[model samples]
Target: MGKITKYLNQLIVGNVFDTPEILEAYSTDRSVLKIKPKFVAFPESTEDIRKLMRFFNQIAAKEIPVSVTARGTGLDEGGADLSSGGLVISTEKLNRMLEIDPRERLVRVQAGITLRELNTALSVSGLTIPIGGHNNDTIGGLISNTPVDDSAGKYGGIESFVERVEVILANGECLQTSRLKKYNIAKKATEKSLEGDIYRKISKLLKTNAELVSEMSKNPTHDYSGYPAIVKLQYKDTLDLMPLFFGAQGTLGVISEVILKAVPLSKRPSRVVATFKELDAALEFAHKVKSLRPRKINFYDLKIIQEARESGKNLDGVIRKLEDGFVVLVSFDGRINSCVKKVANIQKEFPRNTKFIFETPENRLILNEFENALAAYLNSAKSSERVPILTDFYLPARNVSGFLKDLKVLEQKLDLDLALFGSYATSIYSLRPKFNLEDKDFNKKAATFLRAGAYIIDRQDGKLAGGTPEGRLKAVVTNTNMKDAEQILYSEVKRIFDQNNILNPDVKLGANSKFTLTHFRSTSLPKIML
Candidate 1:
């Protein structure tokens, strides 16, 4: 091992692994990228991370190409947190709830704690973070990924809940967003203080580029691809730097701790599935149901339900009851009486031809299973040689039907099998395509298909990759679509935070970055299809 690796082993109290087995295990995430890291360090505390950052700085000064990336549960769709040959800082050991202020309705936690664990602890106070169905995801990962939940129309995502965060800069110095709140006109401006310097610089940048920021804000997408539009910085009267880290994908700095706003748990929750015989009709009904203020509104294509049935899981009772068409699921949460009243209101407003399947408390568990089974069934439907390339994007409610039609046309033109599912409330949809990665010709065609799909979304004035942070795949597309002003602003912000480009290098900023299909783990498998 080199000096840096040896020093990291001595500094971190947890564990540092360099073995082939461990490296191989950390190589791939949910995406198809496979780049084995040179060293994997499990950090147990913020102090360890400080030391690691300092080491990175030292190596970077010596003209070494060393970089660092922090990972949570590795549940990301793409390789946002994955590194090729750099230091991988695994924050799993730092899992701890530092403070829970029930009165303030906020919780301060070590970034590595899982969502499930955090909610379990908060249950005592009858409060919980409102992120949906990602119990296995880590808090840090969720913050970085910025995933939109089923209830995004109601509660929004991590961006809405995050109060503040403590991040370690590229220079090994710690910076807290909470410090920005402490800044006042009465205090003398000190160039010596890092926080003060950053605040002044960012404030000036936003003030000078007010017009550009305003223009970019008009067409905001749920995409966490690059630095968020600077318009978010200008709050009511002052600037808030917390939103900058929401969907940053850890490119700015390592998030050490976060303070999230906690909400009271719902007293009673209810869900109903409304089936429609036509896509256009289901979409129209979904827009009307939005008026009822449901906690979540989700839509699934008929193929998803068909796949579930083919698995022989005895979904006949559920499928037979519904019409052969698109399915929309709406959920409401509050008092039992209020939830019931809301359901009644939805029924009255819904189209008369639509079939409603109200799930009672006794059968609610079954409904949950049915909803979860769709994703599972789609995964099993893929052929052995075919790899899943799932892409998510957002559009306005009025454009969803047109976008769906475009997707159908694209499928026919490319001769590929595809499935769509996601949050109807937010109009954020995911396109899952099965590609034979082993065939070079097929891979080339798949790339063309993605580029074309991106073009379609752009024409619709929609944003690409809404569900997760921009990884290699979406980064290329986002970069191509970014205006000159936006690109320059994004690059400037990246340079300010990570001057040396040691943190998640080449992600969301670098000019030479390219999205390629050669780095996947499946490349090592035999050419034969399973």
Candidate 2:
């Protein structure tokens, strides 16, 4: 331990700590998995990262096998940022505003910067990235996991906003990627290093396996599961490698810095909390609200309210008014009067018992509070350790209510309670189930439930990874859902980016159920150290 720590400290320009305290601290992320890494590196500069990657490359086939998992803020719920007996690169210190092209509505920032920090700085310029996340989530993690955010409904997915990325590849070489022209592709392929090799190999792979790539594009499960579909890799005249790494979960390469498209800060949007006695009524009303093209419609079932109370967490406003039902947070981009009319038009479609709260400030702050209320249960002293076993599934608006009801049936069958919340319009989910982490049967129970839950979702035309990418945890369920061609194509993609299989090996593309179950963590820490 001393030898490795000393070598790591001397290798990177930033700090490397293997102290028991530090190792234990970095072991647990927001996910329900814990993997105590051999060392945690805090590289201050891109050069430091390059040096480390070069070192890893040199040692790739040696006695030491290093699998690198770089995390922005360790907020990935799918266990992507964790690995056993390897180095974890903490990107928190790499945060820096390299450039902000306000004129072009673009911002260049280190991937380590949190969305909240970036927007806090961008507020002066009246600009922001619309696909937002937890305040602690780093921009790198945002791009890596591409988790479903309510804001994506109005704007788009994180993939839509990423203009360019500077990634440190497996061989410790840097590749600056963006939407590239045909000539650019040719030029890149002609290069002599790993960069050119990647361009050349992937181009051939896609061209040779054109049918498989196209088939993957049509597979809903592959939408956010593994690599971006090869068909979606290229447009008419340009090919962009940035999408390939969007949800790669650090298994492909390490995100160093990125140039992201920013939009004019939205004006104060009117928000309302609508509560319904029945989920069917709530989901039906949510669809009507979605037709208005509101910025966001966040839906939470009755289980959310129940969990909050069980955990001794109090939800304010109309959210608590629900005795046994669902709550929807609807936000609009215009005046309060416009919001009122939008609701009036759809109010008749819902149950007469449905209650609405037209909150003040007309901004998402109030709406955000209601959204954060779901997470507030985690802070409760009475809250048990809730494993996020069933996370991030998406369904069509038509299947949400029905499938959710089916989920309840499975829950009762398994006798495991779940907390459900997600963006209504897009049907991206963030569902977690309550469990006692200390229970010896947890792993088997979780695996059984995941398989059954996935069965229900698959039959209902729901994507297992609609909102979140299939990282280490969900990869098990999502992998089985992928077609044989889809699996082969993604494997080839990973081989192209990482020949040695050193960059987060077996993560998004090839993780199995055994690997996932073996790493189910029994311990957890506070979500945000800050």
Candidate 3:
């Protein structure tokens, strides 16, 4: 590393830190895993990244075990940003909004820009990225994980919002990817560089398994286990390779910049904060909202509300009575008349006695502030940590009641006191059980809970990697649970762009239970952003 460090000092514009303190600091992400990187590089520009990648590619060519993981904000609950005994490439310094075309409704920005900052800038243009409900995350991180968007019900997955992506390939070649006609793909395949090789091999493989590829192209319930955008690799005569690269979790390529298709901000927004005396009614309304594909719909079950109350958190506006029922907050954004009519139509489907409020500043401000309740649940007076296992999974709309009952039974069996809540619009649920980390058998219990809960989700037509992307922590769950053919296809895709597996190994493709158990941290030491 001494020789490598010296060479890197002159390689690029950004800082290179291999100090013990820096290595220890960048070791972990939001996930409970700590892997001290041999070197952490903060590349300042696209050229810097390409130089670093080229240098690493040369190192890997020597039969050395060198892997690289990209870091942006380090908000990953999954181990997508962790690399043991390798380099951690931080995109922090590259954070910038390059261009905004209000007329074209396109925003080009560095991938390291935080969602909050991007939205802040886009506010002037009345545009915003359609994915990510959280502000603390970076565009690069979101693009890699492709987590289920809170507003996915309205604007499909990230693919719909992403116009083009600038990716630095494993061998440091810069390739700008977008939808291309078959002839353009053919032209790309004819080139002799790494980019050309990727296009040739991926296009060939996708054509070979065209039917399976086509099946995976459907974005019904986006799977974070494998490539989520495997959907529509080719539509009609157009072929796009971004699907193979974007959500592969930096295992395939490093994203430098992203050109996003921004949507118009809602001028007139209407919200409904409804409390249900019965869970059935709330769930029914939630499904209706899901069908309507509104901008926002969040559901907090009775357990969450009760937990909030027990934690000494005031829910004066949100939950009036701490009883066993559901609290739903659904909002629509558009013209005032359209929002009103849509709200009225959904309301008509329910009984006339439904408790409802138009959700105003003067009225109870519950819908927008319930995140504090979730924080309360995690930081209850008790010392138990809210274990992240069983956090993100998709739930089908049909027979949700029976599936929920099974969840309750599972909760009781584990004695972990699970709380259910998440974006109802996406039908994604977060079930984090409270458990004391100091317990001797904490890891065992978490593993058991994760496996059993994932089984129940699959059995009930639900699936893992819905809300949370399957980083290293849940890789054991998502990878093992995948269909055999799907696994094979993902492997081939990994081989195409990342032939040497030099990019972010032991992640989506190379993940195993042994690595998960070995690397998972106990107290979750987070990386310090530069």
Candidate 4:
């Protein structure tokens, strides 16, 4: 047998599934892209990863295209397409906590460990990872994407908590990268003209400094495109590997293990719910909180508030309208004693009319129930039919109010149903009325709205927000008019980390690439060719 076949069979303990069902399952992410892998391999341990890397190295010797793709919970940016054809290295089986150091306030876990699992494990030790979003994300995936959510203002993000990382390179070399040793490796990598290694070192430096910039620009959430800018910010002049992988999105290498910093478990947890009359009013309040730089801040629109109320989730009368067609919620969480004082301070900035709902333990239970029911309710509602698309964009935090005004104007111009919501400092998402009908008129209208939105965002120096582009619509929406050199930043990074273009080769960012199957199939990639 060929070396690839023999190595995979002999060294990996995980399952290898080549069935059509498995391929279909692995073909798409939450985002658009649709190429399928020739095979899927599930590796259970670092040893299994070592075996797979050896196999990949052997395959690389032949110079055939290959890439590694993985999902913590299958959350992707679009059309669920896997535009690259290669082996899908599934990390699901490699879920184990190697160490938890309470004294150092760090934990080491295998790539497949989900946030929920890690948090639960940490709970036993009376500690917790400070940053997480939506609960289901994998530790590896979060590190790869480097998301900073509610706690970003204070604790920073997944990237900040990352003390060290173990990764397998494109050629199957296992390397352990940390802050202290980053410069040495980076210096050598740079001297050797190794683009991938150099980028990794630079990224680590960037991550170190991202917290400061991120705090100031907190109003509209930052982008997590080619890689987290934090990597460059923290280690821009250093050897930090952070830049190489922060936004590699699993292209450069597989993160086998990570050591992350954690916060002590809150002995007394507290929650504060603040209500606003108008969306603008809530936004104004968010700006102040951003100035104070609180630990966590989340905003909920009227639609979500209504869902919470109607479902009889513990949020009874939690959200009442101050004006027509507007609702807002601000939730604050922290340690009990200090949290009360912080909430008091936050309340002073708001108008006397603003309502406050202090969450008891019972209220917390209700909030969970309400949030859990929200996804289903939104999915089933006919109102969603009116909004066919949701688009997100972020500018500097200070520019958010002006941006929202422009958005409202677009809503009026398009005569489309629209709702906007997001974290005050980090991001804002605009939801267009769902169009359930399959008629050409609906598609055309949706397209028009999307084009208009994209145009406005482009004019404001915004690119697509949230996830990767999946379809033609996403391609157009995210396509930037940036000059070739600027665009190459993304493409060059992609080429370096995803050298063979093996990992999700179809998802091109910052460039003028179309999101489509035909685009992926084409030999020569063009800016707009689909």
Candidate 5:
């Protein structure tokens, strides 16, 4: 441990660990990268982060190149939340539900509170944040990534529910979006404060480049890479910096707390699975079902069904009912009569050969299993020596079929086994390719396939990273596709927030950083068995 580590341990209210075992645990995430941070600090309060930031700034004059990376549940892809060799601040200890105002239908929570914990607490008041089941992910991580989930078509993402956020900037200054009070004359006094200065600077940047900002905002794909272009998305006229932090992957600042808009829990939730003999037919049905505005619409192929069966997922009954082509699953939440009416309307628009399966409460559990079984099954299929590279591509709904075709071409061209999954409603698909790191030939082939896929997505004006931030693997593509003006704005924003580039440095902005396959953990056997 160094002097800084010792000082952090002494100052922080939470525990600081540099033990090999603990360091190893925090080294890697779901991504194919493993670089143990020098020290991992578990912070309990915002004050602790503030003090640490102040110390970091104080030490900056001494020419110490200390960096900070914050993590919630460690479920990120591409190692965006991982500190290469810097300090890792785990917000797990900061988990707390600060307040829940029933009247306003809003909840204020500490950043590290998990979705599971928040939903459990909200259940008491019959309220919920319908951002889907990222039960293991903390609120901070979820907001930071802005992931698209099963319920995204219905409730949208974290941005839909997030009303405000309290962020701790790099200089130990705290800024709150909800505290701006846009129309209040007292805001002038606040302008003189530290938070006010930040708000003003960012607001001016947005206003000055209004036209370019508008053009960038037109990107339909869901992206959490680089600085969030939040000028017009969150607010029409006034400034709302909360969206800036959303999907920033902690590059901008550390989220301390979030005040989210909550909705009442639906009493009658139901799901229905529809099967089609053709993939195009399934997609057409999905388009029609969108008119009814179903809570979620997910489409799976025969490969997914086969994988689930191989993994012993008990999806045999469902598979038996499915056609040779594709299956579309649609979920609805409302009274039984209302749901039934919507299903009837959906069936009318479906092709004559289409088969529909209405899921009972019992069957719903099985449907959930079917939905989640493929990823586990695919992992089981890969050898222990092979590392899985799950790449997310997002495009317009019309281009989904074409994108799938391109993926098929890449699979054949690369001679790799690729599995597809994700939210069809949002036209975002996850391409999971198996790679053996020890085999140099396999690594080169996988890289070629990824580069080709990135080109395809870019051609369609799609997002290379849909659900995850662009870390080492996808950063090259993100940097390539980013416009000159957007790049300039992102750099300026990053400079303003993280002046020293001490927060997740080079992960997003450093275009020169090459994507290499050497840092991942080596395994002789697969972690999962079929």
Candidate 6:
């Protein structure tokens, strides 16, 4: 029997696509890398997924590997690349709100549904999921791999809302895991790590998975393509599925459905804007507001804030003052009285250094003025002698000041315009440093900037735990010890989950500090090569 035909026949409730246009569309995400998949399928339901898993198991039984991945908006560091070319199962067709248990304050949804769609449905009921700050992601995808964003500080994280998940394992076994399963796995991982032929086989399979992920995309953002191999099986009543999937980045299994905690819509949301004379002053204000815990804290530099000014919108003189450095804006949501009180308390506590500007009707009109200013800057730069290269770095909350200092020092060395912004949502800082360089010289300057920033971070003795791929890559390549640790951890994890080696055949495991694909040549060998 033809193996491809047999596998194709087994699929139900999903469309199998293998066309040049479709392949090209699936090849690259938001990032830079491009790859081709042999087949892409979209299932209509969880049962369809189970059938796909069974097919994967059948292939594994014959020592054939299968590659799988789901697609969303591709906001990640290009983590959506299909691993190995055997099969790519797209959950996009599984979009459905299976259940919404209002009394339990939880809702169950198929993995294919987008966050925007889910929120629109919940808007009618006046309930919302406690997801990360960005509302553009998917629930099932988030549960498969936990995502961290601005809401991390106040509402816990994407993991906080997840109550449970339904998954189809690699071997075609249907598994349902609760939130507590992660804590147990974390504890188990702390003990002697598991080792065996099964582990060996899984490890081999993951090598293929890693290869495919690397081949999938070359974007430099926060995507951790393959990670969190352990599938959490149990959760505490208070614990939710949020922890299991939020940052897992889709390694263990494809999440078919997610049970999420739901919250009521806000009655009122008040805008509170603050401006600082310097980056440090703005960061200090962010720290203070952390206690007040507003719904969102957005920091913008004068360079970007110009977007607000050039819109021909009149600002309350605060726009003129923002030229001093940066602005920190916070939005308070909840009861109007309580929000007003909290704003008052915050203003009282940091009276001298911070300036609070109420977002009145006129001010509201220019809320996104900064984006316009940035567009103008970019427009002007595009017409200049050299194209501006944009690179970003993330630092932990406490190291924000230190990271800024390092950037300032680097600014003295490079002839570039550096704009720094702080995040009140997370303990991170974003930097946009622009310089004029020829196309041939861009990579060298980019590498130089990355190396310098990484060196400064290493010298400061700060450990980099999380950030976008670009930021994490800079940290890893710059520091030898961290690189070593990363390589070891990556290899160990890859070995445990993927067993077939078919996942993404073109990529390799433990090869790069960041998720960039490197070429490997294969030699013909006997059937019993293993």
The lDDT values for all models are 0.73, 0.78, 0.77, 0.57, 0.73, 0.54
Q: What stretches of model 2 exceed 4 Å from their correct place?
A: 218-222, 306-322, 349-351, 361-372, 381-383, 527-530
Q: lDDT tens string, model 5, 429-482?
A: 776656665564655565576678788776666788776677666776677777
Residue by residue across 1-530, what tens digits does model 4's lDDT show?
34554556666677666678988777755432346776688877777776665566556657865655655666544432243566777777777999888888878899888888898999998898867365767888776655546566566667677778888765566667754355655555555433445455445433444554455345433554444343243434444555456645666677899888888775443555567766667766666656544555566556655643554445454545533334333444444455566667878777888877666765777555544434533444432233324444455555555666787798788775455555555554545354534443654565577677767665666555443222233545454533343344556555555455555554436223433423222111111100
TM-score, candidate 4, is 0.78
Compared to the true structure, candidate 1 yields what TM-score?
A: 0.92
Candidate 4: C-alpha lDDT:
0.57
For lDDT, the strongest prediction is 2
Per-residue lDDT for 360-398 in model 3, tens only?
666544644554676676556355566566766888767
Q: Please state every model's RMSD to the true fold in angstroms.
A: 3.3, 2.5, 2.7, 6.8, 3.0, 9.5
lDDT for position 494 in model 4? 59
Give every collision pair in model 5. Answer: 384-525, 384-526
Better of 4 and 5 by TM-score: 5
User: What's the TM-score of every candidate structure?
Assistant: 0.92, 0.93, 0.93, 0.78, 0.91, 0.74
Cα lDDT for residue 347, model 1?
A: 69
Best-first order by TM-score: 2, 3, 1, 5, 4, 6
- Candidate 1 CA-lDDT value: 0.73
- lDDT for model 6 comes to 0.54
- Candidates 1 and 2 compared: the better one by TM-score is 2
lDDT of 4 at 179: 49
